[model samples]
Target: MAAYESAIQSRVDCIEIDVSRSSDEVLFTLHGRQGFTTDIRKHKF
Candidate 1:
């Protein structure tokens, strides 16, 4: 994830990440979750 970090550190105005709940209800970052753009998922509650 070095590249990702570098890009973010390059004075990016905005950044997006994909997150999903695991079997244990834990959140995770998934790059390939969506086609092209990242998918950020979170608990409704």
Candidate 2:
């Protein structure tokens, strides 16, 4: 959410967010697949 705010403040024309589903079927947004801090699929949200 902070990233989106920052982009809005910077007057960005467009923004992108990566959405993924966890093992528990919880949906969330992230930046990218590469260099992920943790495996969302393995964690139960």
Best candidate, lDDT? 2
lDDT of 1 by residue, 1-45 (tens): 664686588976666666899999999885543465533444352
Lowest-lDDT window of 10 residues in candidate 1? 36-45
lDDT of 1: 0.65
Q: What lDDT tens digits, residue by residue, belong to model 2 across residues 1-45?
A: 887888799997777777999999999987643665665559885
lDDT of 1 at 4: 64
Q: What TM-score against the true fold does each predicted structure earn?
A: 0.52, 0.57
RMSD of 2: 11.4
For model 2, what is the C-alpha lDDT against the true structure? 0.77
Instruction: Tell me the TM-score of model 2.
Output: 0.57
